[model samples]
Target: MTRNLFLANRIREVLLNGKWIANTNFKEQIINVNWEKAVQKIGNINSIAMLTFHINYYLDGLLKAFVNGKLEINDRFSFDLQPITSAEDWNNLVKDFISNAEKFANAVLALDNSRLDEIFIDEKYDTYLRNIEGVIEHSYYHLGQVVLIKKMFDLQ
Candidate 1:
C-alpha cells in the first residue's frame, strides 16, 4: 500500500525494537556488572558497557539528524554515546541512552511517509527514506552483539 506502513516504517520499527531488546539485555542482576569486570576484555570484542552506549549514541545521532534535516558524524566515527569508563558515568549514559531512544521514536512517528522518501538532497547521506531504516539496522546489529557479549562475559 504505502511506504509508511511498508518500507520506511519497517525500518523505524527495527530502531525501536532494538531499543526494547537492549534495555533488557543488560540487567544488573542478570549480568553482574562490576565496574572493573565490565571493562575486562576476553579477547578483542567490545565490552557490553561499550555496546550499550554505542547503540544509544547512534540512535541519538540519527534521530538528531532526522529532526534537524541533517546527518552529523562525530570525528570518532562511532555510533555509541560517550564511553563509560567509570561507575557513575555508565549509569548516566545508560539513562540518557533510554531517554534518547524515546525521543527518537517520537521523531520518527512525527514524520510523514513523503518526508521519509523526500530525498534528503543534502551532502550527508544523500539518500531518501533511509535515515531511519539505516539507524534501525545499525541498532539491531549492535543489539545482537550486546546479547552475545552479555553471554560471553557472564560465563566467567
Candidate 2:
C-alpha cells in the first residue's frame, strides 16, 4: 500500500476501528459510555464528552482545510464543547464524530502518495502527511484521557 493509504488506515484504526497500538479505539471507548457519566468531571479534568468534542474539533478543522484549501479553526475555541445534557445530544455528537472521521479517512485515501508531501493549504503549517499523522497522534492522546476518565467514573 502507498504511504498515504497507510496513514489513512492508521487514522481509521485509531479513530474508528482496527486497533494497532492501543487495543481499545476511540469509538469502542465512547460508544457504550453513559451520557450522564460522560458529562461528569473528575475533579477539574475535562469530562469524557468535552474530550470527545475536542478531538473531533480538530478533525472537523482538518476536513475543512482539505476541502476548502484553508484552515479556519480557532484554537482557543476548539475546546468549547456544548453541554451534552441528554442521551440524544451525546448520541448525535458521537454520530457526527464517526461520520467526520470516515470522511477524513476517505479523503486521505483518495490522495496520491505525493500529495502527502504537498504543503497543507498554508506554508506556515506542516505538509499534509505531518498534519494527518498529527491528527492520529492527537486522537490517541485524548483517547487515553477518555479511557482513564471512564475508568474513574466506573470506580465512582
Candidate 3:
C-alpha cells in the first residue's frame, strides 16, 4: 500500500476501530454515553460533547485544505462547540464526526503518495504528510481526554 493509504488507515483505526495502541477508539468511547453525561463537566475540563466537536473541527479544516489546496481554519475558535440540548443533538454531532473522519480518511487514501511531500498550502507550516499526521496525533490526544472525562463521570 502507498504511504498515504497507510496514513489514512492509521487515522481510521484510531477513530473507528482496530487500534493497536489502545483498546478503545473514539467511536467506542462515546457510542454509549448518554446525553446527560456527555455534557457533564468535571471541574473546568471540557465536556465529552465539546471534545467531540473540537476533534472534528480540525478534521473538517484539514479536509477542506485537502480539497481546496489551502487551509483557512482559525485556531482560536476551533473549540467553539455548540451547546448540546438533547440526545438527538449529541447523536448528530457524533454522527457528523464519524462521517467526516471517514471522508477525510478516504480523501487521504486517494491522494498521490508524492503529494505527501509537497508543502500544504503554505510553505512555512509543513508538508501535507506532516499536517495529516498531526491531525491523527491531535485526535489521539483528545481521545485520551475523552476517556479520562468518561472515567471521571463513571467515578461520580
Candidate 4:
C-alpha cells in the first residue's frame, strides 16, 4: 500500500474501526455512551464526552488545514467542550466526531506520497507523517483513558 493509504488506515484503525492495536476504536468507545455517563466525572479525570470532543477538535482543525491550507488549532481550546446537557447534544458531538474522523482519514489518503515528508503547516510543527503519527499516538493515549474510565464505571 502507498504511504498515504497506510497512514489513513492507521487513522481509521484508531478513530473508526480496526482492532489490531487497542482492540477498541473511538466509534466503539464513544458511540454508545449516554449523555449522563459521558459527562459524569469519575474523579479528577476528564469525562468521556470531553475526551471525545478533544480528539474531534484536532481532527476538525487538521481536516480544515487540509482543505483551507492553513492550520489554526490551539491546544488551549482543545478540551473546551460546550455543554452537552441533553442526549441530542451528546449525540451531535458523537456524530461530528465520527464524521470528522472519516474526513480526516480521507484527507490523509488523498495526499501524495511526497507530501508526507513536507512540513505540516510550519517547520516547527514537523512533517505531515510526524503529525499524522502523533495523532494516532495521541488518540490511543486518550482512548486508553476512556476505556479505563469506562471500566471504572463498570466496577461501580
The root-mean-square deviation over C-alpha atoms between each candidate and the true structure, in angstroms, is 4.3, 0.9, 1.0, 0.7
Candidate 1 local lDDT, 60-85, one digit each (tens):
77776776766675737663445557
Ranking by TM-score: 4, 2, 3, 1
- Which scores greater on lDDT, model 1 or model 4? 4
Give per-residue lDDT, candidate 4, residue 97. 96
lDDT leader? 4
The segments of candidate 1 whose C-alpha lies over 4 angstroms from its true place after superposition are 1-37, 79-85, 121-128
TM-score per candidate, chains pooled: 0.71, 0.97, 0.96, 0.98
Per-residue lDDT for 132 in model 2? 92
Model 4, residue pairs in steric clash:
none
Instruction: Please write out the lDDT profile of model 2 over residues 30-60, one tens digit for every residue.
Output: 8998899889988999988898898889988
For each candidate, what is the lDDT?
0.61, 0.89, 0.88, 0.94
How does model 4 fare in lDDT?
0.94
Clashes of each: 1, 0, 0, 0
Instruction: Give the 10-residue window scoring lowest on summed lDDT in candidate 4.
Output: 60-69
RMSD of 1: 4.3
Q: What ranges in model 3 sit over 4 Å off?
A: none
Ranking of all predicted structures according to lDDT, beginning with the best and ending with the worst: 4, 2, 3, 1
